[model samples]
Every structure is written in structure tokens, then in C-alpha cells.
Target: MMEAPCKRRRGDDDEDAGDRDRLNALPDSLLREVMSHMKARQVVQTCVLARRWRNLWRSMPCLDVDQDEFTTAGVSVVYSDHEGWERFEDFMDTLLCPGNVSIALLDTLRLHASSMGEDRRASRWIRRGIKYPHAGQEPGLQRGAPSCSSWRLRRLHLSNLYLCNLLAEHVRSRCPSLEDLELESCTCEFPAIASRSLKNLVLKRCALKGFREITSPPTEEPVYQWWL
Candidate 1:
């Protein structure tokens, strides 16, 4: 009982082909580009796909976080179920925690904070995302340490969250490259809106109390629709 050499060779070749990892073979930049199109949750979940993908999401340039994703069949489980809210908060904490996301590479952050039923927690996460002296900065003032002004966040959209007065301060001092800002259905406590680099501002169905001025150079008068 002897096996044929040609058949054995063919079988070995098939196995070798199966062992090849085509997805991993692609360039990291290309893979990340493809990941940019997916939701932030899906991108983070890709870590379970393979070892190489585990840390790939840390450098993602864009993230879109929607609280609705935690819902089940058009009903928000986050507000109804305690465990669900905890899970959502945990996910947000992990995603925005220090040393988790490479802030240097982050370009855009879109947060849909509706249906969370936790305004304080959601507001904290927003602050973490746009804080000036972020956790990603170099530890001390070294010779060639990267400047704190290297923030690359260009566009920020906050939906259905409570924003404090410090938000304006953060935009003016911390985010040097922020150009577009949109706030929808948010209760803003800021007294004024001011930013040097901000070009486009949109406030939709947002509740503003004692909001007096807009310091930014006139830009279409800020598209305010359905102000609350």
C-alpha cells in the first residue's frame, strides 16, 4: 500500500495554499483605509478577526459612535436594561481611554449620544475626546518632544449630549485644526462660541441659554435650524 507521489504533492500544495493569509498580505494602510468605512464598533470588533488586526484600530483616523447600536429591534436597551447601559459605557470608556486610540492619527470623531440616558457619562467622554493636554502627548518637555498643538482633529459632531462652557475653551485653545463643528439636540451651557480655526458651525435643535456671542469671523451666520 504505497501512496502516489504526484497526488501527495498536489495535496501538500493545496494545504500550503490554504495556509496563506491573503488579508494579512495587503498593506496596512490599505487595510486601514477599508476599515475607515465601517462603523467604529465594527472596526473595534475586527480585533477578534486576527492577531494583526488587534491594534490596527488604534491608529484609525475616523470614528463614528452611535448609542443606537446598543439597541435591540428599534428599542433602546441602554435605557431599559441596566446591564446594557453598563456595556455601552464600558465600550465608550475603552474606546476613548488614554493610550487606547492614537490621538495623533485621529482626524474626525462623531458621537451620537442619544438614548444613553447618561448625560454626565456622555459629556465626560466628549471631554476626553477633545481635551487639549490629551493622554497621548509626550510625558515631559524633552528636546524634540512633539508639541501639544499637533492635534489633527478637523471635524467634530456631537449629537444629543450635554455640553458645558469648557467646550468653547477647548475648541479655541486645544483643537488647533478643528474646522467643522455640529451640535444637534444638545443642551449647551457655553456662554459664547469662539474658535480661530472653525470655519463651519451648525446648531440644530440645540438648547442654548445665555449664549451671547460668536467670536469666529463671520461664516454664513452659523446654520441654526430648529433651535431649542
Candidate 2:
């Protein structure tokens, strides 16, 4: 072999294959934790890293979506174009669909939309966040109230959105696990907000021109408090 100048074997001194996959080798929980600190777009982009990470972001315990991530233009332009809004909605649906979310671990959902056009889309996304899929339920069912039996939502933050009385009522009645709710610069005509599990409510710069009152749970602990 020496006389013939033998060729070096490819693996003669190679590092372990696993060494090159350090990030992928991390535990799924740790990986998710890392992804949690990133925006929804960044989290979704990790799918391209490797086959193992393709669906890892789907199980993220927290979701943070902001319209500003897509564009810097005014809300009017962002929502006026049919194709632009459609793409935005589609992207959100893909990320926030009930099937993609990990219900048991989901704790925080933050949706921020700057314009009225995105309000409805934000509302629909919020509903899907708390929605539970029932057995035999048709896939992609767009009608009817969202099932909240499996809701584990604890913290929600909505900004620059329009909400109806029914949506507020549903959140108060259906999401028993909800503890903190923050509505910033929102437009709502709700008469009242009543939640037994709510602890901290923040209404900063919210337009409650049609509001009537804010009622807390019957508990004497005064666990619920509102901040304006």
C-alpha cells in the first residue's frame, strides 16, 4: 500500500456526525424555549434548518404576532390590497391554527394589529388560539363558537383591535384559565367584563365610549383589579 501511495480514507480522522448537529441535538424542550424568545416569523423560519426542526415550532408554548413584522407602511396600504391581506391572513392561519398549537402548554398569546382591517383577522386568530378541536369535528370548520373546554390560555395581550361585546363575553365566560388580559388602544362597546379567573386587567388608552361597567368575580380576595 505504501509503495502504491494509498489514498486517505474519508472517515480516517473525521469528527462525529453528531458534532455538526449540535443545535439539532438539543432537547426539544430546550429548543422550544429558545424559539419562544423569537417572533412567530423567526420561529417558523427554523423549519428550514433541518428535517427534525421542520415541525418543532408548532409546539411552541407562546405565540407573538405583530403586523409590523410584515411591513412598515401604514395600515391602510397593508390592508387595502386584497392579495397582501390575504397573504397575511394565510400566514397567521398557518401559524395559529388549533392543530398547530400545543394546547396543554400554550400560556401566552400576543396579537398586535395596527389597523381596523386587521382587527377581524386578529379576532379570528385569537378565537383559534383558544379553540379546541373535538373528535369527529370537521377539519377547518369556520363556523360556530370555538370550543374552550381544553383552553389552557393564561395570558393574552391585544392591541389596536376592535372587539365586539360577544367576543369579550366569550373570553370572560369560556376561558376559565385566563388570568391576565391587556387591551391597549382597543375599540369595544362591551357593557361589562366579568371573569372569575381574571386577576389583572389592563385597559390602557382603550376606547370604551359605549361601556357600562366593570364587574369582578364574587370572591372577596379581590384578585381582580383593573388598570386604566
The whole-model C-alpha lDDT of candidate 1 against the native structure comes to 0.72
TM-score of 1: 0.77
Q: What would the per-residue lDDT of candidate 2 be over residues 1-228, giving only the tens digit for each residue?
A: 348778877785465554656765789889988888888888889889788988777767678877667764555675565555566677777765545654334677787876666676567655554454232133553323235364557888889888778667766766777788889888877888877788787887887867876666767243433455
Give Cα-based local distance difference scores for all models.
0.72, 0.68
Best by lDDT: 1
Residue 214 displacement in candidate 2 (angstroms): 2.7
Alpha-carbon RMSD of each model = 6.6, 8.0
Candidate 2: minimum summed lDDT over ten consecutive residues — where?
A: 134-143
User: What lDDT does candidate 1 reach at residue 39?
Assistant: 83
Tens-place lDDT digits, model 1, residues 1-228: 987675466588777767656667888889888988888889999999888888778777678888766655544445675555666778888876776674444678788875536765788875665553356433441223234545677888888888888788777777777788889988889898777777778888888988888777554354433455
> What's the CA error at residue 117 for candidate 2, in Å?
3.7
